[model samples]
Target: MKERWELMDDSKIVQLYWDRNEQALTATSDKYGNYCITIAKNILGNKEDAEECVNDTYMRAWNSLPPHRPNILSTYLGKITRNLSFNLYKRNTADKRGGGEVPVVLDEIVDLVSDTDDVEKEIDRRELVKAIDDFLGKLPADKRSIFICRYWYFDSISNIASRFGMTNNYVSVLLNRLRLKLHNYLLERGFEI
Candidate 1:
């Protein structure tokens, strides 16, 4: 059976927010709580921390909805959860003692994404993001999905492999190749490294 909030479409939920209905929080939570928590946990590796980040995501969404409207509520919420989770992950792993896939996952593409401090330049950052998006858009559906699953969702290699029916080593090799392709793709588009 569908929940009451599940019966309401994302637009209606967004409308509830626009109308300043507090129940909007309930609706959003009912619909996207697990989705947000999964994104958080994929990066956080801690259920309590992931849940905390998801709650923070709700607060962030609540505060942002007054002036900003997201066309895709899930994406908006997922982004918030992912960012908050990553922030927490960084803080928790300052001494680099945590065990999880996030560190290894991030390390795989860190150099490809940013060879130097140019990644920190605000003006270049937006353009680079667009370029990377375009590059991902041009990739085959499976490749793109795998890339997003690993980087955006921070999914484990075994999870991705199982979902795609590929071997563990193949997923790793494919991801490595994709990183190389992304590096070359960005270079061709005039991004320094």
Candidate 2:
């Protein structure tokens, strides 16, 4: 089924939100709630925090769309949810109570880049995004989901295997192959190390 966002006009949704229409909020939730939850849960790990993040994202979107008619509402919502979840995670970390899954997942990549270096300098975010999109576009739907679940969503291979009803060994081998391909692509794009 085509996503509701793919079917409905984003500008219309923004207008409805600006008009204070409750149905607009309902429609937005109906369309993007799951997506927001997925992003938040991936970052926050805890269902409670994820739910809070998703609610916060909706409120933010409701307030912002009046002034900022977003061309891509889903992406905007996702970004807000991610930023809010990350901030919450940082606060927890500062309090020495870190518990989110994303922190540990991102830590794996932290050592790969110099602490002082900017991410943009190592890889142009736009170019990297485009490359990733192109790579994903070429993959079969199942393979693409596996790739996203493992790398983008930072799900462990064993976790992903369980989710997809596959063996861990199969997931591991598939991930290894995808990683090699991505490594080569990044190298060709001048991403050193």
lDDT at 87 for candidate 1? 84
Backbone clash total for model 2 is 0
**Candidate-wise lDDT, in order:** 0.87, 0.75
Evaluate model 2: give its lDDT.
Answer: 0.75
Model 1 residue-pair collision total: 0
The deviation in Å at residue 111 for candidate 2 is 6.3
Best by TM-score: 1
By summed lDDT, which 10 consecutive residues of candidate 2 come out lowest?
Answer: 108-117
**Candidate 2 lDDT for residue 180:** 69
All candidates: TM-score: 0.89, 0.74
- Cα lDDT of candidate 1 equals 0.87
